[model samples]
Target: MPVIVVEVMPKPELLDPQGKAVAGALHRLGISDISGVRIGKRFEVTVDEVTDAVLAEVTKLADDMFSNSVIEDVVSISVHPAPASA
Candidate 1:
C-alpha cells in the first residue's frame, strides 16, 4: 500500500489562536529561545496504489475536503511507501 501525507496550515495573514496559545505557554515555561510557532495539520491517507489519478484526487481532496479554503491552505502533499510490519 501507498500512503499520502497532506499538510495544511492557516494562511499567513490570519491569526492562529491555537498556535498563539501554545507559544504563550512555551514562553511561560522558559522557552524564550523560540520566538514564534505556528501549528499545522498532517493527514496520512492509506491507499491500495499510487497513480497519477490517485495523486490528482488526493490533491483535490486536500484542497476541498481536508482544509478550509478561506482560512487554511494545503501546504504540501507527498507520497511514501507503507512501512513494513515488525
Candidate 2:
C-alpha cells in the first residue's frame, strides 16, 4: 500500500477564525512576534498504488468531499511507498 497525505487549507484571501483565535491567544501569552496563523486539514489515505489516474481521482475527491471548494484549496498529495514488511 502507498500512503497518501492530502493537505487542505483556506485560501490566502479568506479569513480563518480558528487561526485568528490561536494567534490572539498566543499574543496574550506574550508571543507578539507571531502575527498570524492559518489552520488547515490533512487527510492520510493508504492505497494499493500511486498512479496518474489515482492522483486525478484523489484531486476530484479532495475538491468534492474533503475540502471547501469556495474557501479552501488542496495544497498537495504526498505518496509514500509501502514498507517491504507489509
lDDT tens readout by residue for model 2, 1-86: 88888999999998999999999999999987898999999998877898998888887898899998799999987888898898
Give the best candidate by lDDT.
1
* lDDT value for model 2: 0.90
Q: Report the C-alpha lDDT of model 1 over 10-74, residue by residue, as the tens digit.
A: 99899999999999999999998998889999999988889999999999999989999999999
How much does each candidate deviate from the true structure in C-alpha RMSD? Answer: 1.4, 1.4
Q: What is candidate 2's CA lDDT for residue 83?
A: 89
> How far does residue 33 in candidate 1 sit from its true spot (Å)?
0.7
Q: Which candidate is the best by TM-score?
A: 1
Single out the weakest 10-residue window by summed lDDT for candidate 1. Answer: 77-86
- Model 1 clash tally? 0
**Clashing pairs in model 2?**
none
